[model samples]
Target: MEFKKFKLIKQMQSTIKKEFIFLLFAAVITSSCRKIFNLPKEKEYLSNNVNFANKILEPVLGRTNLIGGFNGDNSTQPIHFEIVNARYGDGRPVTDIFQKAQTYVWTAAYTGTEKSLAEIEAKRHLEEHPLFEIRSSGEFIMWPSATNDLVTPRPADSTNYPQDTRFFDVKITNTGGERLIRDFQIRPWRERPYDPADDMNLYTGGPAPFPETPYNVLSRNYIRPSRMDNVVGDSTDIDLGNDNYHRNNVLVYIRPFTGGNGHSLRFKVLNKDSVAIDPALFNETEWVRLVHGFNLVKTKEYVQYDVAYPIPLVNLSTIYAPGGSNAYIELKYSRTGFGQQRVTTVLGLNFGIYRAGDWEIVFHFRKDNPRFKDE
Candidate 1:
């Protein structure tokens, strides 16, 4: 018993040292750890031949307005901001989804110390668009005049334009002087919607041939192409275990104003049309987030899930999205500060349309209510 007690004391001492080391590292990491936004850390991962998501889904300049009018009266409401109008890089407006636009632009030219020709033109364009015609009371007009409608977005190639949107003074300013300033990134598949499977399926030779190149297919190894345990002619099928291969999982892409923050995003699967799936089809409750909280690393980024995602083998393609369809999911995000202070449930966002409730899952082209908090 004495020997056992001595061993236990030694083990406890060792454990205490490990715990202390872990806490010290975690604290230092919290402040200086950089985000993983710059992709493909090693030169080996980036290939001229391969097409990565970062290449295709770069952030595009867009518009956002407070959902309802910006109410400054502190007695009436808490200072809230949201995004209303969304547009694409190619000058296509996302009216079907959010369906509202802010009438005003940043007034007073953004005079940078040293400017390029592109910068001069972009700022000139921005100055032309004013937040409100009236200086005293400025609210976004739902019905924009023909003059405002003619105002076009900045040229896509212009560098560092729209970086600062503090053109107008808010009617109600908080202690931090926080306004509706934000970065609006357009979601992928604005015009053309394709299934995840389509992105994964291998591209076989077709029109225009290999020289022209139609390579968008994923690896077929997960389908179990190899024979079982080297049994020469055995018919038994076997799956070579791969713990967390992304190709066989679900991919969720998200964005944020800041990077390198810890947050958790909870989500549940639904039908393609943004409607709840039936019990026979799927249970949104089974899809509810459990003990395995899907934590967000380095703020907003594409997250891939493995066994956590369902794979119904009986019908094969029944549980997930069908070949031609897309999978719809509801998302709710929550984050705390460095000292574990509870931030607002709706952090720095109001999808620019809904005024009363909070929404974080306004992704996809569907126009239905996100119902992010209800579920």
Candidate 2:
């Protein structure tokens, strides 16, 4: 009985020792893992406030063309920008402007959600009560370019047009949304001399100093067709007098309110002829072709004007006769004047589709009287 009791006590002691060894091993592993995961936070050289203030100082005080800045309000001004190879640290290479890096702009307000920078710029204007946060990865800095001709318009009558010049103030803001205003002067870089009698170049004389005009100025107009519809009969028939044949063509006339030159006029054809004749003939035919170029009528002589005067030609596809398809016309013209002026212009049209046996003709303004001005 004494020997059996001694053996039982030995077994209990061995079991306790095994459990204590296992517990110690687990504690060591847990402590080591905690130390491995605890990393130190990264430090930033520039604070948000310092970065925000710098954008305003460099442009005005330093007289630097390139300055880092941001827009507070979602105005036409761009937002979120970065400059490259800019001066940093104690001693860095001071190179020419070519040393600069590509810059990027971000909206002042952003959500924690992931999104692209372009998506942010587009939505920034529409967002209400948006919050933005900005940070640089030490890769680049943001700066503005030299204030030159940021926007320009082509001369209306290149041969006779006097140079159009305008001086406007540019308003800039920083990350904190503080604004900085700078005056920018712009004038037409005329390639030729001006002649008032020459209808071809009415707006261009030579490079002139900026004139007095508001910076944010904009202009618009409403055009009305003098006559909606007219009819023509057989080829031999002269006037047709609105009877036997159908006239599907309409005329639109435009008049401007503001008197400056170097503005563009755009026309959008919203609706088209719905008459259905034949598909095969319509496909082969060039339905929309410039019969006669746009003409400006003056008291002395009528001048033929090419569409490529103010802006580059934006070519549109021809419309087909099965008649459910729609097309549009966008015409851009620039004008320069000393004061308010009125000029009459005409667009010749041929809207009817001809197939051997059947003819399709229809006319209605889908969206008429819409005009925009380039300021």
Candidate 3:
């Protein structure tokens, strides 16, 4: 028995020596890995990135663009998409005038003469114009590029549109039981550029600062279409007219309020909760007074103007076909901020998709009206 006890002690000593040696070796290897090989310790979570901020700062929330996606709200504004204004090709004045991102939605109609640009015609009004509705906030699973394996169209669901290079596909699960897959585009909004007419109007004498220098400030403002809301049956609906004899494709007018001494362009709210769906109600009643291409100031009392302008060549799809569903045309204006970003939502005027001409949906506010009022 005594001999057995002594043997047990010896065994314990041997085990202790082996464990101590192993621990010492492990310590040496771990310390050397960072210095000699620049490797993290075995227990450390491994990541390929040298800079760690990007990993921790993921899913950083920002403002959503028109197409129901997150917009690149950073400055040194890198523009990823193109709008076909005559002013687009000209160089933009880049400046950091805005500290945060901002968005503007300019609703325009192409007059018969102005529809010559190929860029305007290339997009089939509804198919090419992507619409998305984010009903709720959820995790956005991001895919790096359009052609990535993640974007492979589902085999069962054959309804597919050509990929928009401008956006990346990310999906979410809302509080409701619906799953939303949206294309999130990241783009920087630029400052409103100076027009040659501005020389005649804005500055008769100020030396036109070259685009990259002082005159052109990189604008953080952007405007986009609104998210598609399955719940809001009447939201994002714009009216089109039916004047068969005179096929005026798109019509926008600001006629003086008829039969009333006082002129008011007051707006009414229509949504999922409205009493009854209003018919395509654009006529002399829905005239939009525009203050052409003016920047808006945000305050408790917002400002707008009213004026008459020529309408543009209209390209609207047949929305009210027998089996078709009424699509929404909500425009979302976003203002990025250090804290919560400011957002303004504009619902499209509901109109009959089948026949539209003379039928005018009133845009509540005008972009270029000469007269101004605060409300």
Candidate 4:
């Protein structure tokens, strides 16, 4: 028994020597790696004179809008922000801007690759949110359900559109210190979401004149019928309509058809004869990833979606609206033409419908059917 005890002690000593040698080798390797890499220590950043470039904010009501123009010069990441002294245009103290209401919030990450309603619901949740909020990144946000006419007076009449304003100060802070940006102006406008004219007049709440751009290809009446001409052996000879056809064309608008049973949006297309067009023909469109909707239902008549209200839940540009602040839907198809050449055409629109309902947007080809035949 004593011999066995001595043997056990020797075995322990051997094990300890091996472990000590391994640890020493590991320490040397780590030190050498650190020295060879010449890694610098991370420097802590503090915010310096942070200012917002867009001191004048003009957010429309009834939609989620992010207020940008954060000019944080030499500021650390994730700078904290708080709204201070929120009041009306006349400097009266207000609390409506801070009141909470039901709003949609993302629970999981939306990677824009979700395939079904189950996936979308898993990523989103409804929560109560303030009317206006300042995020930690020194940006402001106006929630979807915010509507305070007292702070932002509505137009008395169509001709009497007003630019009632509100004033507030922002308290910006970081690990370094805090600074107050005083007298920031907010001139809220009524909901004028989406557009062929993307920018609505702040004074008129109507279509604003198109901004000067050499590449502006958009039109207010984009979904109009093609003009017809009687030319033999020409594709333009397809008798869609005369030039005056747009005056009596089929109407395209959004209206509720579900009696407000659920939050739903639908789309439909019709030929010149007022007959439904098969949605499957738009082969180049992404139905699943279209418009951030879920539970897609395609039929002979229309394509429907179970969507949250205000068409676009937020005004920011996303996969649903690549240009941001507008809802864009692009439909495309291709056909084999003469000489076996494939021809492709893309038709798109950027528009918005702010009111929540069981809405359906119809596109009726009143003049002529889209030419799909080969020469």
- lDDT (Cα atoms) of all candidates against the true structure: 0.27, 0.27, 0.26, 0.66
Q: Report the poorest 10 consecutive residues by lDDT, candidate 3.
A: 52-61
Where model 2 places Cα greater than 4 Å from the true spot, the runs are 1-163, 174-279, 282-375
The TM-score of candidate 3 is 0.17
Q: Which lDDT tens digits does candidate 2 get at residues 1-375? A: 999999999999999999999999988887776688874433322222322323222121111122234323333223333333323123243223223322223345333222332443453332221011123321112122211122222344443222233322233333435343332222323222111111122133322222232132332111223232222212332222232112323323222223212221222232223222121211221222221123322111111122211111111233221122212222222222225443112222222111111111122232222111211
In candidate 3, what are the lDDT values of residues 91-133, reduced to their tens digit?
Answer: 3321221122222122454332222234333432322111222
CA deviation > 4 Å runs, candidate 4: 1-48, 75-80, 148-163, 173-178, 193-255, 259-261, 272-275, 280-296, 308-328, 334-340, 351-356
- Model 1 CA lDDT for position 206: 17
The better candidate by TM-score, 1 or 2, is: 1
Pairs that clash in candidate 1: 65-84, 83-352, 84-352
Q: Which stretches of candidate 3 lie over 4 Å from their true place?
A: 1-27, 32-246, 253-375
What TM-score quantifies how close candidate 2 is to the native fold?
Answer: 0.16
Name the top lDDT candidate.
4
lDDT of 1 at 28: 67
Query: For all candidates, what are the clash counts?
Result: 3, 31, 40, 1
Candidates in descending TM-score order: 4, 1, 3, 2
Q: Between prediction 1 and prediction 4, which has the larger lDDT?
A: 4
Which one wins by TM-score: 1 or 3? 1
How well is each residue in 1-375 modelled by candidate 4, as lDDT tens digits? Answer: 999999999999999999999999998998888789986645546556678888888787767778887788877666778899977666678676788888778877765556765776677788988888888777789886786442353453434222245678998877666788898876666765433323345455644444454135453332332222221112344433344333433335445676434777888877877888888987767887767787789998888888755655454568887765567776666776668987665555566777666877776666556665555
The best candidate in terms of TM-score: 4
Ranking by lDDT: 4, 1, 2, 3
Better of 3 and 4 by TM-score: 4
